[model samples]
Target: MDRSKRRFVQALGATAAMASLSVSALAARRTTWDLLIVGAGTAGLPAAIFAAGRGRHVLLVDAAPQIGGTMHLSSGQMSAAGTRLQRSQGIIDTPQEHFDDLMRISRGTIDQTIARLAVGEAAETFDWLMSVGFEPLAGHPVSGLAHEPYSKPRYYWGARGARSILEALGPLVDRGVAAGRIDLLLEHRVVELTTSRRGAVTGVAAQDAGGARRELRARNVLLTAGGYASNAAMFEKLSGIPKFVDHSYAYSQGQGLELGESVGGYVRGAEKYLANFGVILASEAQPAPLLARADFYPERRPPWEIYVNAHGRRFIREDMQSVDAREQSLRLQPLMRHWVVFDQSVAERAPPLIVDWEKEDMLAAFDSGAAYFYKADSIDALAGAAGLPPRELAATIEAYNYGVQTGNDFLGRRHLPVPLAKPPFYAIRHQGVSITSTAGLAVDGELRVIRRDGAPVDNLYAAGEILGSGATQGQAFCGGMMVTPAITFGRLLGQRL
Candidate 1:
């Protein structure tokens, strides 16, 4: 075996018995697979493991250099009711409760079919992960941390985030490969879906990274290859939002959606473009850029300052609890740009606003003369330096200060801890950037790909963000929606077939 393969095998603790499976050195057998799944990722890996365990010959193909497609990028945050972990902690939750919580958190914007399926199948998927040594971070399973909160503490993942899921799942896949129940192929991109004369999906056409072509036949095909977030053109076309700062996986090229569309499958849930507002990119790279997102969530740190648009108006109350309200409010502004304006008084009194950044670090960034950060002795100068209308910005600070003294904010903001009367003010620009696919192709609750008229495309199935997060995540990011649903649908569809 190669050096890296030996190391990987040793890390998995497989010993000599499962060394071959641990190292993916065997050529994929040229045989008809009982199940052919594109993308060995959050959804595809779970699907392959379950199907292979059921005595089916599974073929799992990925275009990346190794297994674990987007899991490398995912936070692995998942939510499920009735998990044994929840029971151990005396937490009471059910699929119906989960469904209701999701609907409520999304404000009833999520697709019911997809939501129901995910809520129903989620607990088993989560339990499976835990049974295999997948663990939530210490003192977790909270109501919510990243997005909106659920009614109960049903949200979780690992300390290493999504890698925890991969660490536990990888060896199982390796064992399947070693036992010959599954064929593993990395660096093989599925280029097209092969269909029968009657329009049933029978196989796939793939191209290796070196440009070699091969056709593989299968009884059924599953597309869990993820969304078009990494594709600038497709991301804009489908989402109607600029692919501003992409921090998603590079292999997320929307190939699955293209292949599905080639077979007459239509897209759905494109109207649900939700921006996750917090990115402060260090560079101007279009598709993929290094980003440091601010910890602006109300739960993490109450706003000691106000967020303003390019027009120099406060979008939402500084201490608003609803994360959806804050995000949508930002989405309406120009380029979804927001600038935090705070006075020296507020900065001195309040806890550090940016996560892990102390009061001194905040001053250091401003002193370094970064283009995105600006400071001035007065609001007028601060506006000019930060590219806003001096009059409007000056007026905004005046009204905010008036509210602080008068005990009544014109903007209805309840938390006016300190105002902008002090000199040497601060303002930092932030972009509302996202990496998740908000829209995607249409699919039934059973995960069958469907045409525009709702007719199921024969012998084809899909899961994960390839089905668009809109179908499950809704107009907002419900905590644990993305990863949970992807794994849920993967486990559900695999067993059904």
Candidate 2:
């Protein structure tokens, strides 16, 4: 087995050991639960915690061996307006402002009702985390990072990223389990949603790794089972784009989406599907592992290389400051793929293009025959190796070099450090990919799973990425929109349900 697969197996083994109760034992004890929360990660954990806190009997289950679903992998960045933290910092902000900023960044494509609800309740949700001992990084609450900047400095994350959130939530969940308010079941995948004859979701049928099947009834079923970014087939079917990389949580296999759809719940936001600028994959295979990401942000590293599509045309200004603009431009390209082309001189003199990698490490990639890294003495040879049009590649570089010499770039690029006149041209293929799922099960503002006719699926609710990243973020990635709304909506559901 390869090292990555081996490490994954080892991690699963450790997670399995963390749970002591057998599936049969747990299933035998609880025939009915007040609330059945699926996927004990970001949204489920909060739902379970808040529900149990309200003296409700909650049954929390996950296919993964342990809880803290995507939280283990998420950056854990959250944005909230009018929080104690913001107040302490004396930074005045409001939910309306947050809502407006998200709409502006998303170009008003976001579900305004959902976005408004999330931002409105975000402060309380963030405050609850802080009250529970969640610590933000020192000098945090920045305007933004990779995504478009928010007008206010409301963005915040812990030093440990999403794990920092799990730290705060884990203990509360433990307390609920200890108090017998929450029945925690792990290593069980919910295969089907058991619904009433009237089509109201009543419970779930789950199977353990040992193939032991159990049906657990519930007054309400909350599908916080996360997104389908990890499932290549489902991702492509829903997003209308290929899954280019596998950086999502391993357990995010779209169970929530499937389960919801089985009971009349429909999905939305497929049109809002958008990919990140790009990332260097470990291989050319679909859904490949991420190898490295370039610092495409001009503010971070001015571009010394030109970005070209499969047709070998410079699609966007390399020095464009707006991340959303760059991403939207990439969406129009065939296969959502692009290549970073540069000559040996630019490679040697320019600051490292790949984040965290030095020039030597990058140069080694070409020598090692890395899947996405190609080197050729001529532009035509480099184009052939990288699968770009040779004629167009040469012409594109010629135009770029002419512009560099004359100081008049057609794409309005300002940072023209050097032309591609040097020998041994290099091309690094970067595939546009998204870690979060954009298409998700449709839910009402109150967090109720709804059908295409806009009718609520009784006793069925959803929170977190299962609602789709596009629901809150729209076609653009709004800072902290996904993670923050997930926790906030989950908390609200727990309190209400």
Which of the numbered candidates is closest to the native, going by highest lDDT?
2
Candidate 1 local lDDT, 1-497, one digit each (tens) = 34454334322332323323512433445468889999988899889888988888888877776677788878888889988889989998899999888788787999998888888888998988888879899877888767777889999989888888888888777767656787766667899999989889998988875687778899999998999889999888887767877688888989999989999898888888878875676655665474466677767777888788999988788788887788888878888889999988876888887767777887888899865788999888899888998888888888888999997998787877777788888899888877888777788777899898889989899999898888777888888888988888888777878
Compared with the true structure, the alpha-carbon lDDT of candidate 1 equals 0.81
Lowest summed lDDT across 10 adjacent residues in model 1 is found at 10-19
- Angstrom error of the Cα, residue 52, model 2: value is 0.7
Where model 2 places Cα greater than 4 Å from the true spot, the runs are 1-28
Off by over 4 Å in 1: 1-28, 288-290
Please write out the lDDT profile of model 2 over residues 1-497, one tens digit for every residue: 23432232221222554443535456566778999999888888889889999999999888988788888888999999999989999999999999999889999999989999999999999999999989999997899868989999999999899989988887787677667788777888999999899998899999889897888999999999999989999989987888889899999999889899999998888988888999999987777899999999999889999999999999999999998999999999998889999998998899988899998999999999999899999998999999999999999999999889999998889999999999899999998999999988888888899999999999999999999988889999998998899999889989999
lDDT of 1 at 188: 79
- Computed on alpha carbons, the lDDT of every model, listed in order, comes to 0.81, 0.88
lDDT for 222 (candidate 1): 96
Per-candidate clash tally: 0, 1
